[model samples]
Target: MASVIIIGGGIIGLSSALYLSEAGHQVTILEKGDLSDNCSFGNAGMIVPSHFIPLAAPGMVQQGIKWMFDSKSPFFVRPSLNPDLFSWGIKFLKKANAAHVEESAVPLRDISLLSKKLYEELHQRGEFDFGLVEKGILMFYKTQKAAEEEAHLAEKGKSLGLDMEVLSRDACKSLQPELELDVLGAVHYRCDAHVYPNQLIKGLVSLLEKNCVRIARNHEVSRIETSAGKIASVAAAGERFSADHYIIAGGSWSPAVARLAGLRIPLLPGKGYSFMAKEPEGRMKIPALLAEARVAITPMNGSIRYGGTMEIDRINTRVNLNRVRGIVEAIPKYFPDLHPEMPAEKDIWFGFRPSSPDGLPYIGRSKKLSNLVIATGHGMMGLSLGPATGKLVSQIVSEQQPEIPLSAFSPDRY
Candidate 1:
C-alpha cells in the first residue's frame, strides 16, 4: 500500500484519510488549526440530496445582483477589481444556464446518495454517535415565488428517483406540531438526513488515530517539492514529509496550496456564519431551509443551529452581524414561535467554503502531477459529500475504477 499525505484537515481531508487508511495505505493528515472547529463542524449538518441544482444555475446572477445591495441579504459578492474574482465571475456567467443545471443534476444526485448511504453505514457501526437522524429536511417557503420554485425542485427530485413531496401548510405543521409556522408550504426531502458534525469530526479523528493514521495538528503546508511532474515532498512546520501520493483538500485555502505546486485552482472563499441557540422545547423535529431567505435551521445537540449568507470575498476574520440578523429575522417569519436572538460577534462562528466557479467540486487526479489529487471546491456541501469524495479518492489512488463517473468532477476540467 502507498503512503499518503492529505492537506487541510477539514471534512474532505479527514474523510480521505479515513478511506485511504481503510484501504491499507499509510495516511497522515496535516491540519493548520487544532481541529477544534471548521466549516465541517459549524454547519447546519443537513445531508441534502435535495440540493441538486448547482449554485451556478440560471437566475443566480440576477438574484445575486439584487442581493448585493441589501446589507443583510442571503447572498453577496463583494464588488472588486481583483482579476481572480473577475475571471471567476465570467466563468460563472457562462455556466449559469438551463443546460448546465440539467447536465449537473445526475452527477450531483449520485454522489449525494452515495455519501448518504455511507453516513448510514457509519451510524450503523455505532463506533460513535453523531446524532444521525433521517427524519428528512423541509424547504419552507412563505412567498408564492419561493413556493413555486420549491415545488418545481421537488418535481425534479422525484424525477431523479428521490423521495420528495410538496406539502400544504397544515401538512408541514403536522410534521413539527410544536412549532407554529406562517409559511405557505414546504417540500419535504425525505431522502435527506442530518448529523451532529462535532461528534462526527471528533469520532472520525479518534477512529483514524486508533487505526494508526497520524494527524499532525498546527502543521500548515508551506511548500511543495516537486520533480518530474510529481510531488516529492511537502514542507510544513520546519519538517519535510514525503509520501507516495498527496491530496490537496485545503478547503478555501486550496488555491494557495495548489499554487505552491504550480497549479491554479479557480476557487473563492465564500464566508458564512452560524450560531447555536437553545432549543429546549424540541420544537423542531426536522431540519428546515428557508427558501426565500436562504437560511438553514437544524436541531442538534438539543439546540438549534441557524446558519446562512454567502459572502463571496477574500477569507477574513470579521463577522458581519447584519447577515446574522437576516437569519434571525427570517426564522420568526417562517416558524412564528421560534425566534433566535442575534448572537454576539464572539458567539458567531464563521467558515470559508471553497466555492468553484461552476459550482461543482474538483475531485480527481491532477493532470500536471501524476501522484497528486485535488479534492476541494465543495462549496456548501463539503460535509454532505465528504465520505463519497474520500472513497473516490481511495479508488483513484488504488488504480481501481471509481464507483461513479469522474467526468463531471474532473480536476483538470478547467
Candidate 2:
C-alpha cells in the first residue's frame, strides 16, 4: 500500500487520512495550526443536499457589486489590488449561468447525500458524539415573491425525490413553536442534518489517532520536493518528509501550495463570520436559512450560531466589522424577537472558506502531477462534503473506480 501524506489538517485533510488509513494505506496528516480549530471548527454543520445552487449563480455578480458597496448587505467583496483576486472575480462573474448551475446541481446533491450516509454509518459505529441532528433545514422568507422563488427550488427538490415540505407562517410557527417567526412562508428540506463544529473536529481528531494516523500539527509546508513528475517529499518548518502520494486539501492555501509543484488552481478565500449567542434569548429549534438575508442560524448541542457573509478576497485574516455587523443585522429581520445586543460584542470570529470561481469544489488528481491530488475549493459546503471527498481521494490513491462522476468537480476544469 502507498504511504499517503496530506496537507492542511482541517476536515478535508483529517477525513482523507481516515479514508486512506481505512484503505490499508499508512497515512500522515500535516496541519499548520492547532487540531482543535480552523475552518472545521467554525462552520455551519449542515449536511444539506438541498444546497445544489453554487455561490456563482446568475445575478450574484450584480448583487455582489451592490453588496460590496452596501455595508449592511449579506455578501461583500472587499476591494483589493491583487491580480489573482481580479482574475477569480472575472471568472466567477463569467461562469454564472443556468447551464453552469445545472451542471453543478447533480454532483453536489449526490455527494452530499453520499456524505450524509457515510456520517450516519460512522455514527452507528460509535466513533464520536458531535450532536448530529436530522430534523431538516427550514428556508424561511418574509415576502410572497421570496416564497415564490423558493417554491421553484422546492419543486426542483421534489423532482429529485428529496423530502421537501412547504409551510405557511402558522405552519412555520408550529415547526418552531417557542419563538415568534416573522416569515410569510417556508420551504423545508427534511434530508438535511446539523452538528456542532467543535465537537466534530475534536472527535475526528481522536478517531484518527485511534486509527494510528500520524498527526503533524503546527508545521506549515514550505516547499514540496518532486521528481520525475511525482511527489518525493514535502518541506515544512525546516524539515522534509517523504511519502508515496500527496494530497493538497489546504483550503484557501491550496493554490499557493500547488504553485510549489507548478500547478495553477484558482482558489480564493471567501472570508465568513459567525458568533454564538451565549444565552440567546429567542428560540430557534430547527436550523433555518433566512432567504432574503442569506444568513444561516443553527442550534448546536449547546450554543446557537448565526453565520453568513461571503467576502471574496485574498486570504487575509482581517475581520471586517461591517460584514460581521451585516450578519447581526440580517438575523433579526426573520427573528425579530432576538436580542439587540447580538452584534454589539466585539468578540468576533472569522474563517476563510476555500472558494472556487465556479462554486463547485475541485476534487481529483492534478493533471500535471501523478501523485498529487487536489481536494480544496469546497467554499461554504466543505464540512458537508468532507467525508465523501475523502472517500473519493482515497479511492483515487488506491486505484479504485470513483463512486460518482468527477466531471462536475474537475480540478483542471478552469
Candidate 3:
C-alpha cells in the first residue's frame, strides 16, 4: 500500500484522504492553517450540475472589460504588473471563445454529476449528516435577453440528458413563494443540489480521523524536495514529510506549491465572499442564483447565505467593503421582501478560488514527477467537484481507469 501525503486540508484534500484511506492506503493531510476554514468554507454550498459552461466563455472578455470600470461589479480583474498575472490574463483571453466553452461543457457536466452521485451515496451510508439537500437550484434572470440566453442553455442541458426547465415568473414564485422575486423568468436545473459546506468538512474530518488518516493542521507546506524526476519529501511546519505518493490540492496556493517541484501551473486566486444571516421571515425554499447580479443565495439548515464576487486579484484576505455593499444592494432587487441588514465587515467571509485561464480543474499526475499528482484550479466549482476529484485521484494512484475523461483537466495541458 502506498503512503500518501496530501497538501491542503480543504475539501479537496480531505476528500482525497477519505478515498485513499478507503482504498487501503495510509494517508496524511498537511494543512497550512486550521482545518476549520478554507475556500471550501464560506461558499454558496451549491452542488452545481447546472454550471456546465466554463468561465472563459465567449463575450466574457468584453464583459470583463466593461466591469473593470465598476468597483462593485460582481466580476472584477485587478490590473497588475505581476508577470504571472499578465501571462495568465493573456492565456485566458486566448481561450475565452466558443471552442473552449464547447470543449469544457461535457467534462464539467460529467464531474458535477459524479460528485452529486457521490454525495447521495455518502448520505445513504448515514456516516454523517451535512445537510445534504437535493432541492435543485434556480437561475433567476431579470432581463428578457438573459432569460432567452438561459433558456438556450437549458435546451443544451436537456440535450445532454440533464433535467432542466424554463420557469416563468409565476412558476418561479410558486417554487419560492416565500420570496418576492421581481424577475422575468428562471431556469430550474433539477440536477443541481445544495449542502452545508462547514458541516460537510466537519463530518469528513471526523470520518478521516476515525479511519486513522493522519491530519496535521497548521502544518504549512513550504518546500518540496525532489530527486530523479520524482518527489522525495516535502517540508512543512519546519519538518520534512515523506510519503510513497504526493498529492497537491492546495487550492489557490497550488501554483506556488508546484514551483517547489520545478513545475509551473498557471493559477490565479479569484476571491469570493459570503456571509450567513438568520433566515428571513419567509426564506426561499430552493437555492437560487441571481444571474444578473451574479449572487448566490442558499438557505442552509439554520441560516441563509448570500455569496458572490469573482475578484481576480493577488492572494490576500483583505475584505472589500464595496463588494459586500454590492451584494447587500442586490438582495432587495432580487427578493423585494427580504431586507437584511448589512453585515459588518468583519463578519464577511472571503476565500480564494484557484481559477485556471480555461476554467477547468487541474487533476492528473505531473509529466515530470512520477510520484506526484496535481489537483487544483477548480475555481468556483470546488465544493461541487471535490468528491469526484478525490475519487479520480484515488483511481490514478491505484493505476485504475478514471471514471471520466481527464484530457480536459490535465495539469500539464498548459
Candidate 4:
C-alpha cells in the first residue's frame, strides 16, 4: 500500500484521507490549524445536487459588477492590481457564457448525486451522527424575476433527473406552517439534503484517527521537494515528512502551496461569513436559499445557521459585519415571523473559499508532478462535493478507473 501525505486538513483533505485510508493506504493529514474550525465547519451544510450552474455562468459578470458597489451585497470583487486576479478575471469572462453553463451541468449533477449517495451510506453506518436529513431545501424568491429564474432552474433540474418542483407561496407555507413567509414562490429541491457540518467534521476526524490515519495538526507545509517530476517529500513546521504520494487539498492557500513546487494555480479566496442563532421553536423544517439575496439558512443542531456573501479577494482575517447584517436582515424579509439579531464580530465565522476561474474544482493528478494529486478550488460547494472528490482522488491514486470522467475536473486543464 502506498503512503500518502495530504496537506490542508479541511473537508477536501479530510475526505481524501478517509477514502485513502479505507483503500488500505497509509494516510496522514497535515493541518495548519487545530482542526476545530475550517471551511468544512460553519457552513450552510446543504448537500445540494440542485446547484448545477457554475459560478462563471452567463450574466454573472454583469451581476457581479452591479453588486460590487453595494457594501452588503451578496457578491463583491475587490479591485486589485494583482496580475493573478487580472488573469483569473479574463478567464472568468471568457467562460461566462451560456455554452459553458450547458456543458458544465452534467458533470456537476453527476458528482453531486454521487456525493449524496455516499453521504447516505455514511449516515447508515451509524458510526457517528452528523444530522443528515433529506427533507430537501427550499429556494425562496421574492421578486417575479427571481421566481422566473428559479422556475427555469427547476425545469433544468428535472431534465437532469433531479427531483425539483416550483411551488407557490401558499404551497411553501404549507410545508413550513409555523414560519410566516413573505416570498412570491419557491423551488423545493427534493434531491438536496442538509447535515450538521460541525458534527460531520469532528466525527470524520475521530473515525480517521481510530482507523489509524495520523492527523498532524498545526503542521503547515512550507516546502515541497520534487525528484524527477514527482514529489519526494514535504517539509512543514521545520520537520520533514516523506510519503509515496502527496495530495494538495489546501483550500484558499493551495496557490501558495503549489507555488513551492513551481506551479501556478489560478485561484482566489472568496471570504464568506456565518453565525448561529437560537431557533427554539424549530419552526424551519427545511433549509432555505434566498434567491435574490444569496443567503443560506439551515436548521441544524437545534439552532439556525445563516450564511452568505462572496467577497473575492486575498485571504485575510478581517470580518465584514455589513455582510453579516445583510444575512440577518434578509432572514426576516423572507420568514416574516423569524427575526435573528445580528451577531457580534466575535460570533461570526468566516472562511475563504478557493474559487477557480472556470467554476469547476481541480481534482486530478498534476501533469508536472507525477505523485501529486491536486484537489481544491471547490468554491462554495466544498462540503457538498467532498466525498465524491475524495473517492475520485483515491481511485486516481490506486490507478483504478474513476467513478466519473475526470476531463471536467482536470487540474491541468488551464
Candidate 5:
C-alpha cells in the first residue's frame, strides 16, 4: 500500500483521504486552515446531476460583461491586472462555445451520477445523518426568456437520460402547495439530491479519524520537493512530510500550490456567499434554485440557507453588502411569502470556488510527476462531485482504470 499525503482538508481532500484509506493506503491530510471552517463546510450542499453544461457556455461572455457593471449581479468579473487572471480570461473566452459545453456534458453527468450513488451508499451505512435527501431540485424561472432557456436545457438533459420535467406554473404550485411561489414555470430535475454540508464535514472528519487517517490541522503546505520526475515530499508548517504519493486538492489555492511543484494549473478563485435562516416560517419540501437570480435555497436539516453570486476576483473573504442584499431581495422574488430577515454581513459565509476556465475539474495524475495527482478546479460542483472524484483518485492511485473517461477533465487540456 502506498503512503499518501493530501493537501487541503476540505471536502475534496477529505473525500479523497476516505477512499484512499478504505483502499488500504496510509493517508494523511495537511490542512492550511482550521478544519471546522473551510470551503465545504458552509456551501449550498447540492448534489446536482442536472447541471450538465459547463460554466464556459455560449453567451456567458456577453452576460458576464453586462453583469460587470452591476455590483449586485449574480455573475461579476472584477477587472484586474493580474497575469493569471488575464491568461485565465483568454482561455475562458476560447472555451466559451457550444463545442466545449457538449464535450463536458457526458463526463459531468457520469461523475455526478456516480457521486449520487456513492452518497446514497454512504448514507445507508448509518454513519451519520447529514440530511441526505433525494427530493429533487426545483429550478424556477420568472420570465419567458428564462423559462425557454431552461426548457431547452431540460430537453438536452432529457436526451442525456436525465429525469427532467418542465412544469407550468400551476403544475409547479401543485407540487409545492405549502408555499406561495411567484414563478411562471419550473424545471424539476429528479436526478439531483441535497445534503447539509456542515453535518457531512463533521461526520467525515470523525469517520476518517476512527479509520486512522492523520489530519494535521492548521498546517499549510508551502514547498513541494520534486526529484527525478516524482514528488519526494511536501513541506508544510515548517515540517517536511514524505509520502509515496501526493494529491493536491487545495480548492482555490490549488494553482499556487502547484506552482511550488513547478507546475501551472489555470484556475481562478470565484467567490460566493451563503447565509442561514434558522427555523424559517415558510415551508419547503425540497431545495430550489431561482433561475433568474442564480440564488440557491436549501432547507437543510432544521435551518434554511440562501446562497448565490459568483464574483471572479482575488482571494479574500471580504463580504460585499450589496451582494448579500441581492441574495436577500432575490429570495422573496421567488418565494413570495418567505421573506426572512436579511443576515448581517458578519453572519454571511463566503468562500472561493476553484473555477477552471472550461468549467471542468482537474482530476488526474500529473504527466511529468507520476506520483503527483491533481484534483482541484471543481468550480461550483465540488460538493456534488466530491465522492466520485475521491473514488476516481483512489482508482488512479491503485493503477486501476477510472470508471469514467478523464479526457474532458485532463490537467493538460489547456
Candidate 6:
C-alpha cells in the first residue's frame, strides 16, 4: 500500500485521510492550524445537490460588476493589481456561458448526490453523532421574477432526478409552518441535507485516530522537493516528509503549497461571514436558502446558523461588521421575529473559500508534479463535495480510474 500525506487538515484533508486509511494505506495529514477551526465550521451545513450551477454562468459577469463596489453586497470582487486575478477573471468571463453551465451541471449535481449518499453511509455505520438531517432545502424568493427564474432552475434539477418542487408563497408557508416567510415563492429540493461541521470533524477525527491515521496539526509545509517531475519530499516544520503520494487541500491558502512544486494555480480567497443563534421560536425542519437576500439558514444540531456573503477581496482574517450586518438584516426579513442582537464582532465569523473563477474545483494531479494532487478551489461547495472528492483522490492514488471525468476539473484547464 502506498504511503500518502495529505496537506490541509480541513474537511477535505480529513476526509481524504479517512478514505485513504480505509483503503489500507498509511496516511498522514498536515494542518497549518488547530485541527478544530476553519471556514468549514461556520458554513450553512448544507449538502447541496441543488447547487448544480457553477458561479461563472451567464449574466453573472454583469451581476458581479454591478455589485462589485457594494461592501454589503452578497458578492464582491475587489479589483486587484494581481496578474493571476486578472487572468482568472478574463477566463471566468469567457466561461460564463449557458452551454458551459449546462455541461458542468450534471457533474456538479452527481458529485454532490454521491457525497450526500456517502454521508448517509457514514452515519449508518453509527460511529458518531453529527446532526445529519436530510430535510430538504428551500430557495425562497421575494419577487415574481426571482421565483420564476429559480423555478426554471428547479425544473432543471427535477430533470436530473433530484426531488424538486416549486412552491408558491402559500405552499412554502405550508412546508415551513413555523417561519413567517415573506416571499413570493420557493423551490424546494428534497435531495439535500444538513450537518454541523464541527460534529462531523470530531467524528471523523476520532475515526481516523482509531484507524491509526497520523494527523500533524499546527504546522506548515514550507517546500516541496521535486526530481524529474516527481515530488521527492515535502519540507515542513523542520522535517522532510516523503510519501508515495500527496493531496494538497489547503483550502483558500492552497496556492502557497502548490507553488512549492512549481504549479501556478490561480486560487483566490473569497471571504464569508457567519454566526449562530438559538432556533427562532418557530423553527423550520428544512434548511432553506433565502434567494433574494442571498443568505443561507440551517437548523444545525439544535441551534440555527446564519451564513452568507462572498467578499472577494482582503486576504486577512479580519471580520467586517458591515458585511455581518447585511446577513443579520436578512434574517428578520424571512423569520420576522428572529433578532440577532449580539455585537457583530462577538457573533462574527469569517473564513475564506478557495475560489476559482469557473466555479469548478481543480481536482487532479498536475502534469508538472507527478505525485502531487491538486484539490483546492472548491469555493462554497467544499463541504458538499468533500466525500466525492476524497473518493476520487483515493482512486487516483491507487492508480485506478477516476470515478468521474477529470477534464472538467483539471488544474490547468484555465
TM-scores, one per candidate: 0.99, 0.97, 0.99, 0.99, 0.99, 0.97
In candidate 4, which residue ranges exceed 4 Å CA deviation? none
Candidate 2 lDDT over residue span 1-414, tens digit each: 989989989899888998999999999888888776688677888889898889889878877778777877778777779898889988987889888888788888898888998888878888689888889999999888888989998998888878898889898888768878777988988989888888888998898999999998888899887888898889887889888889999999889889888889998888888888764543677898999888888887656788888877777767778777777777777887775355654566788999999999999998778988899999999999999999999999998998988888999988
Could you tell me the lDDT of residue 130 within candidate 2?
A: 81
Clashes of 5: 0
Residue range 1-414, candidate 3, lDDT tens digits: 999999988899998999999999999999999887888889899999889999999989999999899878899999889999999998999999998888888999999999999999999999999989898999999998898899999999998889999999999988867678888989999999999998999999999999999999899888899999899999999889999999999999888889988999999999999998898464678998988999999998767899999999999868988988899899889788777678998889999999999999999999999999989999999999999999999999989999999999999998
Candidate 5's C-alpha runs over 4 A off are 280-282
390 Cα displacement, candidate 4 (Å)? 0.7
Give all candidates' CA lDDT scores. Answer: 0.94, 0.86, 0.92, 0.94, 0.92, 0.85
List clash counts for every candidate, in order.
0, 0, 0, 0, 0, 0
Per-residue alpha-carbon lDDT of candidate 6 for residues 1-414, written as tens digits (9 for 90 to 100) = 999999998888888888888889999988888776777888888999989999889988888888777767798887889877788788888889999999999889878887888899988989998889888888888887897799899889889988988888888888767677777888888888889888988888889999999888877999888998889988778978999998999998888888888878887888988888876464678887988789998887667788898877647867778777888888778777677765547667778998998899989888888888888889999998898889888888888888778788898886
Which TM-score value belongs to model 3? 0.99
Instruction: Kindly list the per-residue Cα lDDT of model 5 for residues 336-376, writing each as its tens digit.
Output: 88886878778889989999999999999999899999999
Of 2 and 3, the candidate ahead on lDDT is 3
RMSD of 5: 0.9
Judged by whole-model lDDT over C-alpha atoms, candidate 3 comes out at 0.92
List clashing residue pairs in candidate 2.
none
lDDT of 3 at 92: 96
Which of the predicted structures, 3 or 6, would earn the higher TM-score when compared with the native? 3
What TM-score should be assigned to candidate 1? Answer: 0.99
Candidate 5 global lDDT? 0.92
Better of 1 and 5 by TM-score: 1
